[model samples]
Target: MDGRPMTFAKMLEETYTDGIAVLHRGKLIYERYFGALKPHKPHIGMSVTKSFTGVLAGILVTEGKIDPQAPVTDYVPELKASAFGDARVHEVMDMTTGLEYTEVYTDRNSHVWGLRRANGMAPIPPNYDGPTTIFDFLVAQKKQGEHGKAFAYKTVNTDVLAWICRRASGLTLSDLLSERIWTQIGAEEDAHYHVDRIGTESGGGGLSTTLRDLARFGETMRNHGRFNGRQIVPSSVVEDISRGGDPEKFKPAGYTTLPGASYRNQWWVTHNPHGAYMARGVHGQGIYVDPKAEMVIARYASHPVAGNAANDPVTLPAYMALAKALIAGG
Candidate 1:
């Protein structure tokens, strides 16, 4: 893929993809499993969970339970003294907040590790006096720069949005997801979100689901949030997300793998001719949807690296090539 032609199977192997399901016109066209994954086994979704949280927030917004233009403190007053004190809900949802927290995964001292420990994804030392809960961790964050200025891929913003969604809807993340999405998608198996010490779902990146279920969710988004003969998510929300955010805001992030791409409602918009976008996670997990080609690809993987930069170069080209082939043959 770097220069020469690469086969689809070679791309999968090179990216360490565990499972993938491709859908065309709401029908299963290709599916495969590898590594230790099975058709029904739930795989860690990583930051892909942020997209789910975003959709849930959109649902709440459509119901008039949330006001995105309002300050973050309007829903969670406790964060009024934190970095989010001067931020708006929409800034957090779009990850354009100027928080001091750092999310470099390879840096052990990065603030993301603190979040992982607080969210029950990492080991906490017995003498650790840092924030032990996600809420506490969020409240301790400090401001770095002006909010709503540029895009920064921080998991904490998604958690903050999830917290706002809970406050506005009077429902926990897991319960809300089950009631609004999981149950409505006709999922074959139950999905779960890893929780913090006080049973709060790690809405940032804690979701796990079967490959097929992931594909279903992708198809739902592809169809403008309708699936299983019902409107699972409002068409307006999907349309807004599909329309995308400011690429200028997304450019400073320096994601060389995704030029001219924007982050909207936790999804990555390609701004390409195919009107393609994706919900992506660390270590290669993703749901790539090409609207013009009527294609959706849901994948779970375990790459040695934790960033999508490694996976994008290999997988993204293959996806686009396949989309072009589908359109040409049709």
Candidate 2:
């Protein structure tokens, strides 16, 4: 050991994080829980759930169960009249759909809040009369720009893709994740998803899992979707995600915090030499995998800021620094 104390407990205490876990060479090197969080507790993953949805879609694609080139409406015909009618499945997976929904987390009236209401994450007014379900919200969305033209980080796109995954596989989001991933990855505990009154998993931002299980998932991806000597997800799926989407298209998204980042299959690609990529969520949930350094970091937090931009400056550099140190010691 370097004796520099990269323990998760220290990281959590110093950063004010809820939980932190680090895995190196498939072994737990550090782990910690703080502030109402425990090793066995299932902390909210926020949009980290989207990465699971994306991987499920990849499995469907690899199994020839879903066609990425096909119109999204092909699988969910109910959306034929909505903005997604003309969008391709890949567009949704890559978050390139130009939907009018705004993801401004700070705005109470933002489409993200509307999504929270529809998915039953937030309390709605008694007389509120908007789309009552996620599906309804999708069906009611209007076009903002042309699809496939640029990247727009919209949670609805993931929810739509999740619906497509469910329809194609005939499995709920939780079941698909459980069967295709959690169980196969040797997850330490069962994960749960927050659902609406009708019992629909909030595929966009509803999952909660132990910090160890979250690390297991990240390690699985780092190892090309294989864990416990089994192929949980097709290697190609991980390849596609790590390879990332078009950076040119991502530039217009204007993520000032991530100057050279690209969006791919709901994962954020840093495009650095270490090939570090991440599954990030609102309020600071993250699973970072650095292939070159053989490191994986899973974190769950409840920062007042919903945007990762506010947290990335400190967290991103720290992650890179730690990865480099791990590699140096090895």
lDDT of each: 0.95, 0.89
Model 2 agreement with the true structure over 25-129: per-residue lDDT tens digits: 998998877789999889999999999999999999999999999999889999988899899999999999988999998899899889999999888888999
Evaluate model 2: give its TM-score. Answer: 0.96
Minimum summed lDDT over a 10-residue window in model 1 is located at 1-10
| TM-score computed on alpha carbons, candidate 1 | 0.99
lDDT score, residue 265, model 2?
95
| Residue pairs that clash (backbone atoms under 3 angstroms), model 1 | none
TM-score of each: 0.99, 0.96
Scored by lDDT, model 1 comes in at: 0.95
Please name the candidate that would achieve the greatest lDDT relative to the true structure: 1
State residue 269's C-alpha deviation in candidate 2, in Å. 0.5
Clash-forming residue pairs, model 2: none
